[model samples]
Target: MPVGEEVREAWRADLDPKIQAVRRLARRYGARLLAADGMFAALSATARPEHWSADGVHLTPAGHAALAAAWLRLVA
Candidate 1:
């Protein structure tokens, strides 16, 4: 499938702040970036990777690639 705007939007809502902080770190070396809703929610709720995956251990290669590609967009 072609890369589309919805991919970026979903990543932003569910993943962008993490990616943005990573990008900032790449550009700023040791400097810190601001935290957002992710941290606020983390403080109030349990952390979860399963929320984003189908199973605890196994993930389809497409799923892995989609995750990797999202990060690659930030670094690239």
Candidate 2:
């Protein structure tokens, strides 16, 4: 498989289950889950290279701004 497909497969196999578990635990505790995974997935679908670092594991400044915006929206 290509590198992109590998990454997507890893996300589905690894990160997705962790996100689901956290969402479930947050609901059980009545805590506010940030839902960053869904937001990042949506942003990734837009194919915005600037939002991600060259390593593809970290966020760029634009990505941080977007995260802050999401947090504000959640708290507001």
Model 1 weakest lDDT span, ten residues long: 35-44
TM-score of each: 0.28, 0.77
Query: Number of backbone collisions per candidate, in order?
Result: 0, 0
Compared with the true structure, what per-residue lDDT tens digits does model 2 show for residues 1-76? 1237678687679877888899999999999889987787788788665454444567778778888999999899
Q: TM-score for candidate 2, please give it.
A: 0.77
Question: Candidate 2: where is the Cα deviation over 4 Å?
Answer: 1-3, 47-50
How far residue 68's Cα lies from its native spot in candidate 2, in Å, is 0.7
Query: Listing every candidate in turn, what is its Cα RMSD in Å to the true structure after a full C-alpha superposition?
Result: 13.1, 3.0
Local distance difference test, candidate 2:
0.76
